[model samples]
Target: MTLVAFRYWLAGMSLALATLVTPLSTAQAISPLGGPRFAAVLMDADTNEILYAEQATAIRHPASITKVMTLYIVFDALDAGRLRLDDRVVMTPRAVSQRPSKLGIGVGQSLSVEEAISVVAVKSANDVAVALAEKVGGSEENFARLMTAKARQLGMRQTVFANASGLPDPAHFTSAQDIAILSAAMIRHHPDRYRCFSEQSYSYGRLRLANHNKLLGVVPGLDGIKTGFTNDSGFTLTASAIRGGRRLIAVVLGSPSGWQRDRDITTLLNTGFTALDIRRNGGIEDMPALLSSAGFTLNRSLRPVPQLATLDVEEGDGE
Candidate 1:
C-alpha cells in the first residue's frame, strides 16, 4: 500500500482494535481550558499537599501525556515478570502505520520492551504506544481499560483513557490534579522504572530521538515526567522537579505554545519551592505574579469547571 493509504488502514485497524465508535465531531464533548487558556497545579510529592492550583480539577484532553499512564502499565508488567526489556515485540502493520511523532519502525521490525518504553517516553511515538498496548493487554482498547482502572487505583479520580497514544479523542480526558497524582505515583510507587522518564534520548535502529521534556536540562532539579500537545489540547505538560530534598509535581495544560507552557510550569515550581523556603533561585517576591493576575486562584481550593480540551515534532519536540 502507498504510505498514505497504509496510514488510513492502520487507523482503521486501531479503531477496530479499540472497538469504540464516537462521532467524528466528538471534539465538542470537552471544552479546552478557558481564561488564559491554562490549567495548572503544583503539589508536594512527599506530603501530598496542594501548594498552588488553578482549575486543578478542570477536565482537559491529555494529548500524548496519556503515554505516562501507558508507561505505568509497562512498568507494572515488567515488575510482575509478565514482560521483559529484551523480549522483542514484533511490529505489525497496525503499529508500523500509526500517525506521526512516531519512531517509524517498519512492519515486521521488532523492538524490545525497554526500547519501546524509551521511545514512548521521549518521542511520544504513537506507533510504539500501540505496540505496548498490544504487547501487554492484547489490544489498545484493553490496555486503555487497564489504564483507566489503574488510574482509579492510583487516585487519579478524573482520568479516563480512550487510547494508549493520547491522540485527539474527546473522550480521552484528565485533570491537572489527576496528572499530578500520576506523576507522583510514578516516582513514589516505582522508583526503579521512573528513571526512564529522565532519559535524554533513545536510539532505535538509525533513529536517535531526544526527549521532548525541556525542563530536564534547563531547570535545576527538574527531572521528569512528560509533555504533550495536539491542535485541540494545545501545549500541555506534566513535570516533576526536586529541590532541597523535596520533590514537587506540576501539571500545566492548554498553553498557547511550548514556551508558554514551560514558562508557566517553571513559575509554578519556583513559587512552590519559594513557599517552602527551599528555592535556590529566588524568593517569593521574585516569583512571578502571573498566577494571580492571569486568573489562577493560587493558595485556594477551587471547584472543577466543566470539560475542555502536541509539541511541534518538526521543531524537534515530541508530543
Candidate 2:
C-alpha cells in the first residue's frame, strides 16, 4: 500500500484508541517513507545517545510490552536474592484466571521461578506474569505499584503500571522512551538473565509456546527484548541488536499489524546501524534495499499465534 493509504488504514483501525490515550510528548521526525503513524526510539545502548526518535516520550498503551517491566522487577528480585531461579511459584486462582497468550498452569500447581520467567519471556504468558507478581509483591496490584516506583527510579518518568500482566488497563501505559530506559536498565543491571528475551520457545509438558518477537531470527544482530499487543495497544516491540561491539535498542509502538511492527523495527535497526557506521555480519545496505531484501513488506513473516488449546488454564479477561 502507498504510505498515505497505509496511514489512513492505520487511523481507521484505531478510532477508539485516540480517546483511550494521548501522547504526552510529540515526535518531530517525520515518519520514514512508507511508514505508519507511531511512536519510536532508537538508542546506542552503551553510549546512551539518541540515534533517532519519533514520539519517543509519547504516552501509548503498552499492552503486553508491560511484561518488560514485569520481567525487570523479577530480575531485580533475583539480583537482591529475594527470589531464586529454583524458587517455586504456586499458581493462584487469580493467576489461573488471566486471558490467553498464557501458560495454562492450574491453581495450586507450581513451577520454578526460573521456569516462570522463561514462560513469560518466551510466550508473553499473562498467567505466569500475574503469578510472578504475586510471588514478588503479594498481589498484582501491589506489584504494579512497585513497577511504577521502579520505573521512576530508572528515569522512565512517563510510565505507569496498572497490572503485572499488561492487560488492557487505560491507566497502564508507557512511552517508547520509557521502554528504552527499561530495556537499557535491564541490559546494564542483569545481563545474565536478559537472554530469556531471546528464547524462541518454552515447553510445558506436551505443549510448546513460541516467542512473539519475530525479529530474533530475521535480523542479523537482533537479540531481543519483548513484543506486545492488544486490540487497544496495536503491536509494540522493544528490540536490541549487537554488531561490532555496539548495541542498539529500538522501540516501535502502535503498528497496525504484527508484520508492520517487525518491518518498521528492521528498518529502524538498519537506519541506526548505518548512522553508527556499524556493519552487519554480512555487510550492510540502505533501508529500502535492506528491508526489501529482508522481505518485511512482501513477506507475511508473522509470529505464529499459538493455538489457545495448547494452554491448559481456564481463561478469563486478559490481553
Candidate 3:
C-alpha cells in the first residue's frame, strides 16, 4: 500500500488499541520528585495505572513535551479523515520564521505531511511544528486551542497550551503528572502512530537531526516518545518502554542533566517492572525482554550539551 494509505490504516488500527482508557478524576496524581525541581511518574500504559509519582500534580513548564499533544492531534486528524499524510504542508513565512533545531525549511517550501512529521520527530523543528499546527488547526492559535481542549478532555487539570511547538510561552504550562497522562494516551491510544517518536535520526538536506530522548537508544525495549528542553523548562523527557507484557511511561521534568534524565528513566523503569514482576510472580526475576538480548544497549544518549547541566527554569518557577 502507498505510504499515505498505510498511514491512514495504521492510525485507524491504533484507535482499536485504545483499550487503555481512563476516566476523569479530581484527584491529583502522584509525582516522583522529592523536591520542587523534579517531577516524575511511572504509569502503566496498558492499564492506565499510575504505579508511582513524585510532585506529579505540581503545574510546571513541559518544555517540548508539548509535542506529545501535537502528535496526538496529528494522529487524531489522520484518524478522523481530515487530512492525508501525502497532503502538501506548505510552509508559511510564519512557520519558517519560528526558531532553531529545525529542518531549516524555508517559507514557500513544501513537504508532504509524512515528511513534515519526520522533521518534527527527528529534529523537533519548530518550523515543522507550526506547519503541522497550521494544517491541523488552521493557525497556531487555533491549534493551541485544540490542544488545550484535548488536554481538558483527557482530564489534564492544570495544563494549558499557547502554541503547537512548545516554544517558550508564559501561558503554556503543564505539570509532569499531566504529561504522564498525555504520554500514556499516546502509547495506549495511538500505539501505531507513536512509533514515530522512536526514530533515532533523520536528515533534511545536509542537516541531520537525532531524537532528543536518549533512553530509546540505550535502554532496551524503549520503542518511542518525545523529549524537550528550554531556558524556561529545563530538561524534560517523556519516555516509554515495554518489557514482557508490562509497559510504563516515565516522565521526568526539570531534570538537571541528560545523564540524570536517562538515569532517572532507567531507574523508574527498573523499579516499575521490578514491582510488577514481584507482584505477579511473587519475586523479582529477569525481565522477558532482557533475556532476549541483554546488553543490547545502544547509544541512545546523545552527546551531552554543556548547557544541559546548567539549564535554567522559566521565570515562573513556582507559579
Best by TM-score: 1
Candidate 3 lDDT over residue span 1-319, tens digit each: 9854554454334322221233122122212322225667778888878776666776667767787799799989999899899999989998988766466667888999888887787678787888899998778877777777677778787777778888777667777778988988877788788888888887766767777776767887888787877655667888888999778888887666667777877877876777787778776544433422333122222223234354333321110
Residue lDDT tens for model 2, 151-215: 76788767778798877766667778999989999988989899998888778778888888878
Error of 2 at 210 (Å): 1.1
Total residue pair clashes for candidate 1: 7
The residue ranges of model 2 lying beyond 4 angstroms of the native Cα positions read: 1-37, 278-319
TM-scores, all models, native as reference: 0.80, 0.77, 0.78
State the lDDT of candidate 1 residue by residue for 91-115, as single tens digits. 8788777777888768888888888
Model 3 misplaced stretches (Cα beyond 4 Å): 1-36, 283-319
What total of clashing residue pairs does each candidate reach? Answer: 7, 2, 8
Regions of model 1 farther than 4 Å from truth: 1-37, 278-318
Order candidates by TM-score, high to low. 1, 3, 2
lDDT of candidates 1 onward, in order: 0.76, 0.74, 0.71
Q: By lDDT, who's the top model here?
A: 1
